[model samples]
Target: MIDSFLTSYKIILASNSPRRKQFLTDLKIPFEVKTANIDEVYPDHLVKGEITDYLAKLKAAPLEKDLKDNQILITSDTIVWHNDTALGKPVNEAEAFSMLSNLSGTNHQVISSVCLTTKKQQLVESVTTEVTFKDLTPEEINYYIANYQPFDKAGAYGIQEWIGYIGITSIAGSYNNVVGLPTAKFYELLKKLV
Candidate 1:
């Protein structure tokens, strides 16, 4: 399907995320990774998807001037929203523990935004997945923090890791969205853009 839509276009993924790289590889769409040092900051007034959407677009801004006629650039951002607040990647061990403790026995939304840019046009879209967690004991949380060191993941967890295996109770949307990318929506948009 991608071959039909993406023919003759050079696809570029402007992110350092292994999950995003793997997603494109899994789709058999050839792409190159080119990331810029962009500050992932958004205004306090931006809410929910706006935050991620803005960041995703921010990531692609550096590559806009460098894009060739047929080159397509993709950038993305994922954040966890719990209790009307966004839980970004933990800055330290204590923060990771606190974030996990807060997420325990509760439901949260994982929102991922993707920006697709070309010289002629740009598109930004996002997906939200609801994830519920089983009540986690302090020992379990400690064990995960000590072993997994989830400082790089939003909500201090990875849905494909050991913590997810035991802590997650259920999910209401795309599991891949929680992992980092929403492959279904990503593919649909890629098909249209390519």
Candidate 2:
């Protein structure tokens, strides 16, 4: 289905995330992976979705100049927002534990933003998913950290992982958004373009 819609453009996914790659592949949209190393720093005043929007666009900027007429570059970023603070990818096991601990028995927002850059136009959009966790025990958190090692994931959790299967009580929005990409919103955007 997506093949017919996306055939006019050569899609390039500018991310290192396996989940994002899988999302595109599952959609049956042909794309190639290209990653750019960029500092994801944003101004301190930016909050919530702004931070992700900035980072996603930052990831796309370098590729903007090089995009061929037929190439459409997609870049994305996700953040765990709790208590007015943004929890990004943890730098270490200790930080991951702390992030998960903070998330225990609380409601947090998973915000994902995507930037689409083509030769003539650029667009950025974001989706927010509210996720609630049941109170997590130290033993459970430690077990997950030791085995899954979610240091690379924001909020130190993956909704499709073991922790999510057993720890999360409920969620209010797109489950795929929490995984890193919002396929429904993304597909709508692509449909508009093609």
**Best candidate according to lDDT:** 2
Candidate RMSDs in Å, in order, are 1.0, 1.0
How much lDDT does each candidate structure score? 0.91, 0.92
lDDT of 1 by residue, 13-109 (tens): 9988888899889888899999899778999998888989999999999888999998999988999999889889999989998999999999999
Please report, as a residue range, the 10-residue window in candidate 1 with the lowest summed lDDT: 1-10
Residue 161, model 1, lDDT: 93
User: Please, what is the TM-score per model?
Assistant: 0.97, 0.97
Model 2, 3-44: lDDT tens per residue? 765877899999989999999999888999998889889999
Residue-level lDDT for 72 in candidate 2 = 90
Clashing residue pairs found in predicted model 1: none
> How many clashes in each structure?
0, 0
